[model samples]
Target: MLLPDLVRTAARRSPHAPAVRDGAATATYAELDALADRCAHALADLGVRPGDRVVLWTSKSIDTVAVMQAVLRLGAAYVPVAPSNPRPRVQCIADGCAARLVLADDDLAGLRTRPGQTLNDAAATPADCAFILYTSGSTGAPKGVSISHRNALSFVCWAAEETGLDASDRLANHAPFNFDLSVFDLYGAFLAGACVDLVPATLAFAPEALTRFLFEREITVWYSVPSALQLMTADGGLLDGDPPPALRVCVFAGEPFPIADVLRLRAAWPAVRLFNWYGPTETNVCTSYEVTAHDLTRTRPLPIGQACSGDQVWLDPPGADVGEIVVDGPTVMLGYWGQPAQDGPYRTGDFGRIGPDGNLEYVGRRDHMVKVRGHRVEPSEIEAVLATHPAVAAAAVVVVGAGLDSRIHAAVVPAGDARPTMLGLKAHCAAHLPTYMVVDAVRLVAELPRTANGKVDRAAVTALWAEAVVRG
Candidate 1:
């Protein structure tokens, strides 16, 4: 089935059910369907045709969700641009997709055009491009990942079944629409006739407000980057508050969940089913691990688990225990937009190994490996050990200098009121890591720098260290 069909099916099954909620506004399945129809005709009048790309640059709201459904109804691929993104980045994505038209929040006021009399469910095929998600490229230009309807449905269908999502489930849409993590929150809910509560960008960083919002909305299924979860539990005192009885499933992806933080969450909400999902945007959640009591006792990072339904995951150079992760199956993206089509498995550029338990253990990214004193080191190894420290909430290792001058530096974010000392952290690292792998310098900071998508911005972290060196 195509992506739009998910909403259409839900609309038919439960017309009056709440489909999406944003702030004070709520859209029922029937209203959402009707809005999409009207928006589709409006786009058609504006010269948008089947197969054309339309840019949806708006904040998280029911209108944004309606625009997406409208684009899908017309058989056109929608490229979502976060409202927080600068104008230049929006322009870059529009130009890259050769978008036929750009629709912003302002356009919603005028989207009540004449409704299209007929709905063409077959306007787009399973193989047709569904959406283009742009991710940061090393070259400073964003590269768009083109995903087909089949690619998205593979994960959406599996997730709905695996989690037993139903009309009763209230999913939290935490990630911005532009981010791939939001795809599951949006489509997965629609596929299961569930309701989605759109979390506004303004409240995403305000942990206290967000925590209250989650309970107020009666969020049943929560998904976001681990950093957001950490912030909610750490600063918002989520654990100190009364337990949210409605919260049943909690899933985190986008980055590793600090082992200590995960343990804390497990202790605070032992009844909730927690999941650690792992994958890049190119492949939406290829592997996931359900948190168990034993997992909380682990000092090392948790395993990413096996592949989900309709997906195949394997390591490159199959015989080796550790190698780059390679993905094959329906969920694999078509390719980077404007790039040549690739065959066989998509090399994820991430390193991993099959452990004795037959689970996929993430070993950091291949590009993240750096050479210091002629010895190769994976920063995750050092970061993992440092994260085990009671005082360290999060840690990132970056390599600085060149050749003989090259050295590894560690940046740490303290947990609670525990102030970490450079010498103490060094001694802690000495106990676990090789002398060569031990960082040359350590700095404590209030928080780690993060990109728009919530991943650690290594370059920004390096700049912070560089600025500190200059001041010294």
Candidate 2:
């Protein structure tokens, strides 16, 4: 089925049901459908024909959601650009997609188009492009991932059924539209005939406020990166207060969740179902692991678990326990937008191993492993050890130089009233890590820099270290 059909089905099944909630405003299924129809007509009037690409440069709101569905309704794909993005980055995405039109907040002014005739739904097939999500390329260029209707449906359909979501459920959308995590938030809710509570970007860093919002909205389902959850639990007093009784399901992805933090969360919310989802933007949630009570005893990172329905995962180099992860399935993207389509399984640069229990264990990225003094070192290995420190809330390890001169630098966020000294952390590492694995420099910050998607901004952290060195 096409992507937009999900919304249409929900509208037909429960037209009066709440479909989306943005702050005090709520849109019913019927109202949302009508808004999407109107937006589609307006875009079509602007010459956005079938198969054309349109850039949605706006913040998270009811209007942005309408634009997304409207793009699909018109048989075209929408490329979402986060409103937080700089003008140059937005311009780069627009130029890359050769977008037919750019839709912004104020740009909708004077856009007066009566609802046009709805296009034949059958005209768009599962193979049609649904959206193009751009990844922050390490090479200073944005790479757009082209996802199709089939690609999205493969994950959405399974998630909706597996999680037992229904019209009574309310899903919390914490990720930005530009991020792939929002796909399941928007489409999965529609598929399940449920409502989605849109969490604005401004509330992302304010953990206390976000927690209050979640409880006030009575959100049933929650999904976001682990960092957000960590902040909520540690600084936001999520556990200090009464548990949110309405929260039933909690899903985390994008990066690894520290094992210690996971145990703490499990202790606090013993009844809530927790899941660790794993995937890249090219493939949305290829694998997931349900956190069991036994998992709390784990001293290492949680396993990524088995492949999701309609997806296939295999490690490169055949029988090796650890190797690059390769994914093949309907959920895999068609390819990078405007580039040649890739055949067969998409080889994710991430490395992982099959545990004895038949679950996948992620070992940092292949490229993230640096050779220091001819000894291979994974930054995650060091970071994991650092997180075990009682005083450290979060930690990241980065390589500072190249070849023999290369050195490991550590950045840490102190937990609660704990003021960890550089000498204290160094001594702690000396007891746990090898001499070579010990960090050469350490810096403490209130919090780590995060990308638009909420992952630790490694590049930004590296640059900050460089700036500190020059100043000293």
Candidate 3:
């Protein structure tokens, strides 16, 4: 069945049950289904046809989800552009997708279509493209990852089973739709006939606001980036207070969680099942590991766990230092839209290795690997070491240079007034990491730059480092 089929099924199972909730707005399954039909009819009125690309540019809200489902019902592929994105980036994505229609909220007066209307409700074959997600390009131009309806359905089916999601589950829609993590939040919740609480953009970043929304809404399943979780852990009385009564599972991805923070979360919500997930936007969460009772060490790094329910992960044996992660699975995107397909398997550009326990562990990005003088350096290694320090709030390391020789430059947000001096931080790295991985320079910042999806904005950090070097 197609993704929209799941929504229809949910509505059939519980017409009056709450399906989506925004600040002062909530839609039961019947209302959501009827509205999606209206949206589909509205798009058709705007000349959108089957297989047409439609851009749904809106923040995390119930309206965005309705438009998404509506596009599917009309047999058109939905392209979700993060509302937080810059104008140029949004326009670039629309152009790249060759979108036939653009839908935005506050255009209610413009929608002259009636309810109980739809272009189609048939399943898209595996060969039919469902959506195109554009990656945040740090090295160059952004590439569109084309995913089919069957490709995403397979991943969410597995996610639903693995996470024990069901009708009783109330999943929090925390990530922006532009980020692939939202795929799980949307589809996984639908597969289980679960309610999706749309966390507002303003509240998503604020720890107290997020905490209030969670318990107030009785969210049972939570998913977000590790950085956001870190902020919540650092907040006063956030972790120490009573956990959300309905919270059962907490899934984290987009970046590695510091072990200390994981432990802190465990301490705060002892009953919640914690999982560390890993995947690129091209592949929607190919692997995951559930934290166990005994593995609660504040100093250890969490493993990326085994492959997902229907996925296979392999580490390329390039050399001893690192290898690129290669994935072959249904969840893997067909290829970048408008780009030629590679004959071989999808190579994730990420560096990783298979541990003795047969778990996959990420090292860093292949491009993120820097050459210091003559030695190759992994910035993640230095960042990992820096995060071990009590003073570091967040850390990002980037390579900067014009010639063959480059230096390791770092941006750090320190905790409290006891900041680590550049010399002392370098010494700390020299002690833990290899000589090549030592920081050449450290610049303290109030906060690390972030992309629209909340991931570390390496491009912005690189620009700052380059500007500093030129000024010097």
Candidate 1: which stretches are off by over 4 Å? 113-118
lDDT of 3: 0.81
Write down the lDDT that model 2 would get.
0.88
The alpha-carbon deviation from the true structure for residue 257 of candidate 2, after best TM-score superposition, in angstroms, is 0.8
Per-residue C-alpha lDDT of model 2 across residues 131-220, encoded as one tens digit per residue: 999987777899999999999999998888877898899999999998989988998899988999999898987899988987999999
Superposition error at 432 for model 3 (Å):
2.1
Candidate topping TM-score: 1
C-alpha lDDT (0 to 100) for residue 120 of candidate 1: 66
- Candidate with better TM-score, 1 vs 2: 1
- Give the alpha carbon lDDT tens digit for every residue of 1-472 in model 1: 8988888999999999999998899999998988888888888779888898998888888888988898888899999988878888899999998999988888876886665455664367898998999888878999999999998998888888888798999999999988999998999999989999999898887789989988889999999999888888878878887778899999999888878888888878888989888888888889989987877667667788999858889998988978999998888889998988657678999999887778898888888988999888899878988998999999999999878899899899998899989888889989998898888898888889988777888889999889998998
lDDT for position 3 in model 3: 84
How far out, in Å, is residue 265 in model 1? Answer: 1.2
The whole-model lDDT of each prediction reads 0.87, 0.88, 0.81
Give each model's clash number: 0, 0, 0
